[model samples]
Target: MSIEELNQELTRLRQCLQQLKTDNAELRQAVLEYTTQLKQHKSEQQAALLERQRIEEQLQTTQQFLYSVIQTMPVAVFVKDVVDLRIVLCNQAAEKLAGVSADEILGKNDYDLFPREEADFFTTRDREALNSKKLLEIPEEIIRTKSGETRILQIKKAPILDSQGQPKYLLVVRYDITEHKQAEAQLKQQAIELEQTLKELQSTQAQLIQSEKMSSLGQLVAGVAHEINNPVNFISGNLTYANKYIQQLLNLLHLYRINYPNPAQEIQMTIQEMEFDFLVEDLLKLLSSMEIGAERIQQIVVSLRIFSRLDEAELKAVDIHQGIESTLSILEHRLKPRANHVEIQVLKDYDDLPLVECYAGQLNQVFMNILSNAIDALEEALIQGKLSHNHPQIRICTQQLNAQQIVIRIIDNGLGIPEQVKQKLFDPFFTTKDVGKGTGLGLSISYQIITERHGGSLECVSSLEEGAELIITIPVVQPKQ
Candidate 1:
């Protein structure tokens, strides 16, 4: 019994040992698996920490770069909180513009930094920018610094957006523009002064040229009139006597014919062959024609003298109509028909006017210029086939405008001047004619004569295809210097 029991106990003991070995093996495997899992978790934690550190460094670098950009800009830059419109960030330029330190400017609202009116304006603009989420530009604004100095500025405001596309802050930029504005104004003033000086120089030049021209013309005309006057006086004086002698001779012949009714055959044949009766009538007719021609020559000589007016240099009361007629006489040849061109007819409407106090010779010269220009316009119309009326004509009208003033108007039926061309018509050296055909100073000088020399006004009215009218108004008595 002891042996059997011993053998059974030994087998049980071996089985139990085997069971314990299996359990120990399973326990070792579980411990190894737990150790491997713990190592993997620790590695994952380390990688996450490294990535977080790297992100923090990148964020710091980006902030530094943005700050540097804002600090170095030339313009005054400010950043404000969207909620309270309070300034959160400012650059050195902003501090200088405000004439204050950054410590005082930071975390302050516009109301605290500026006057009430300026603050209101700034706040309104900030709100508008934030609400619209767009950039706003102000072309100009006035700002008073801490030193009480006024300055002009151009400003721009923009809303900074966040990741969710919402406004986070307001950014403002301002540029000083006072000096630029002042320079622009100075340039404009200088330009005006230069233009005035140019006008004065041109006027002086015109006066000199016209004076020389008028003097030369006067000398030549005076000489011609003197020469013609002597001849015309002699011829006119002799024609009267010759006419009387012819009448006496005809009376003597009549007496002989009455007294010697019966004559010798030879004498009667002579009288018949000579046609004595017809000869007597024809001779009287010839004498009458000679007298008329002599008178016409005398009148022409007088007209020439009047037109010269070399001695009438000072202002004097003159017959305006006589001066006009003299100018027409001088330009008669130009008014006549030319090759392939019709005659230019002139119509006059005269009013009763008193003698005007003016320089006679100078006034005549003005008349000559205006009339010549009218003729040129008519001729140009004919050349270009732009004449509205078949008969190219000039109309001259005169009237007393008031008790102290008189007006004259010269109108033409021709191709009218364009508005653009008419504006510069009175300028010196401005002309529509060929370079050689015109000096281009005639109208300019005429304008000076009427306005500056005689204290008058000259105006031109014209339209395209509707002809032109030039009007002149002058005082009857000039103002005393």
Candidate 2:
């Protein structure tokens, strides 16, 4: 009985021991799993902390870069609150421009720093920008700083929107533009002045041309008068003789009648006293002289009328040669008055040229100026002993350069202009002659009429101690644009 009982108890004890060992092994596995889980959680937390630090550093760098960029920009930048229209933010440029520190200007309205009028203008513009929710640019404006310095500003304004698409602030940018505007104004003024000067010069030139023409006309009148005086005097003497002869013839008739009436002695005495035969011969001679004188006077009057046709205002096709002849007639007096030892000879090389379309009166003036100057040159040469024994000559040549162009040259052997004087010969009020003797405008006006008014060219060529040649080239036909 004892042996069976012992074996059963031992078996029970062995079973319990095995169960305890299994529970211990399970507990050890559970501890190792918990330790691995704790280690993994610590590693994840450390990685998250490092990521957060890196993002913070990046955010700080971005803020610093934006601040630096805004401060260094040339344009003044400012921001205002939309609701209150008060300045909320301003850059360093804006602060400097306003002549105030940032602390004093922040949160201040425009009215606090500027006059009421200026403030209202700024506020109106800001409101318009905010209402439109678009950029507004003003090309120019007047801005006054806190230091009372005024400047012209070019401004651009834009509205800033919040995340909800609501207007949050107004952004304004400004640049000074005073100097540029001033320069533009000055340039415009200078242009106006230049235009006025050109007009004045043109007017002065026209007056000069008129004066030269009048002088030529006066000379022409004197010459025509002198030429007619001799014929008129002869005609007057012949008419007186003819009247005396007619009286004598009447007396002879009366004496013959009386003698037949039975008074022979008295009739014979009257006939002898009258000298009837001689009176008859003289009367015929006087009548012939009077007829010749009347014809000569008619010719002069016709020539004068033809030459003065230039006084008309209408433009016409005119023969250039005829115009030249008329000008010579006008200058005839000047030539004869100085006809001493100096012989004035004219060499004409006129070609068969077509009529030119021009203002006859104005063109005549141009011719008169040139011809008068030439005559004066010859006179000067005579007075200065430069024309001794040598023939003082004037040459006039006309030629058709082409179908559309004509050239006329006037050459004179006189005291030629010096190079220095020649450069300014066409300048108004410049003359080599004494004051009151010559008006310094003849050549200047001639230049304007030839070049500016008629689109022709008038040029002078001369050498020291040589002769002067004036060449005028004009277009025969004006071209249509």
Candidate 3:
């Protein structure tokens, strides 16, 4: 009984021990699987951490690049929140222009730094850009800085949209344009001043021409009056003598009637008293003198009429020689007194030429001015004793340069103009003569009429003590319309 029980118990104990060993093995396998899974999970977590760090570094680099680009830009750049109209971001240029730091300007409204009016302008522009979702470019504007200085700026504004396509901020770019505006204003002012100066010059020229014409008329009137007086006086004296002779002849006829009645004594007395032969000869002489004086008066009147034809303002063909001759005749009185003992010689070298189309009155004025100057030169020479009375001469020549041009040259042997004076001879109010004696506008006006009005040239060629030669060249044909 004891052996059988021991064997069964031992069998039970072995089965239990085997079961314990199997359970231990299964637990070890399960622990190894759980350990491998835990190691794999730790490796995956480490790789994820490194990837996160790498992405963070890339993000830092991107932010630095964006900051550098915004700072280095030349034009002023700034961003403002559209919702609250507050400055969101600003570059280095914008901060420099504002005279403030980015930290101070950020989240600040434009009105805090600029005037309300200027701030309103910026607000209006920003609003328009956001509403239209398009860029707004203003070629020019004025911006006030924190220092209360106004700066001209060319500005461009654009909207920045959010992910929902809604405008979130406005980007503004500006450049200084003050110098360009100032230059434009200066140019405009200069142009106006130049135009005014030109008008003044033209007016002065016209006045000079008018004054010269009046002076010429005054001289002509005086000379013509003197010339007319002489002939009129002679004619009056001759008529007076003729009247006395007519009375004597009447008395002689009366005596002849009385002698018919008493024939001898009365006839002899009347003949003695009347001086019949003398009376007849005196009447004939008086009548001839009157006739000559009348002829002289008529000739002077004709010349007077021709010399005063400067009142009209029309162009016509006029013979140059006739004009020269008329001018000489008008100036004859001034010439005669000086030429009395000098034996003045005149040389004429006239060519056959066509009549020039010009304002006759104006051309005559030119001739009078030139010829009068010549006469004055000769007189001055005589007074100064520069001439020795050895055939002192005045020469005039007219020649045709071509079919369309003619030249009139007036040369004298008087003292010539000085070198320094020659340059200003044709300028108004510049003259070599004494102040009261000459107005200094004769040559200037003559030059105007010839060159500006008639499209001609008037020039003087002279040397000290060598006499002067003035050449005037005019076109034969009229200028084109």
| Best candidate according to lDDT | 1
lDDT of all predictions, in order shown?
A: 0.88, 0.79, 0.80
- lDDT (C-alpha) at residue 457 in model 1: 91
Q: Estimate each model's TM-score.
A: 0.68, 0.46, 0.48
Give the per-residue lDDT of model 2 (tens digit) for 1-481: 5977888888888899898989888888988888888888888888888888888888889988887888889878898999888998888988888998999989899998899999999999999999999999999999888888888899999999999887999999998777787888898999899976886776566575565666576457546756776777677667777667877876886687666765579766876698756766776776777767676565455445445563444557788888788667656666553446455788999989999876665676788788888877777778787755467788999999999889999998887879998898888767888878777777878887788767899999998668789998888865543
> What lDDT tens digits, residue by residue, belong to model 1 across residues 1-481?
6999999999999999999999999999998998888898888889889888999899899899988988998889999999898899999999989999999999999999889999998899889999999999999999899889898999999999999999999999999888898898899999999987897787778779778877987898888889888987898898889888888988997898899998889999998999988988888888888888887667766677777788888888988999888888778778889896899898999999999999889888888888999898888889787786769888999999998999999999887889898999888878889989987788888898899999999889999878899998999998998
For model 3, what is the error of residue 373's alpha carbon versus the real structure, in angstroms, after optimal superposition? 0.9
Give the Å error, residue 227, model 2. Answer: 17
Residue lDDT tens for model 3, 36-100: 98898888889898889999999999988987998899778888898877988899899988989
Sorting all predicted structures by TM-score, with the top scorer first, yields: 1, 3, 2
Segments of candidate 3 deviating more than 4 angstroms = 1-289, 310-312, 338-343
* Clashing residue pairs found in predicted model 2: none
Clashes of each: 0, 0, 0
Q: Given candidate 3, what's the lDDT at residue 136? A: 96
RMSD of each: 6.1, 21.9, 21.0
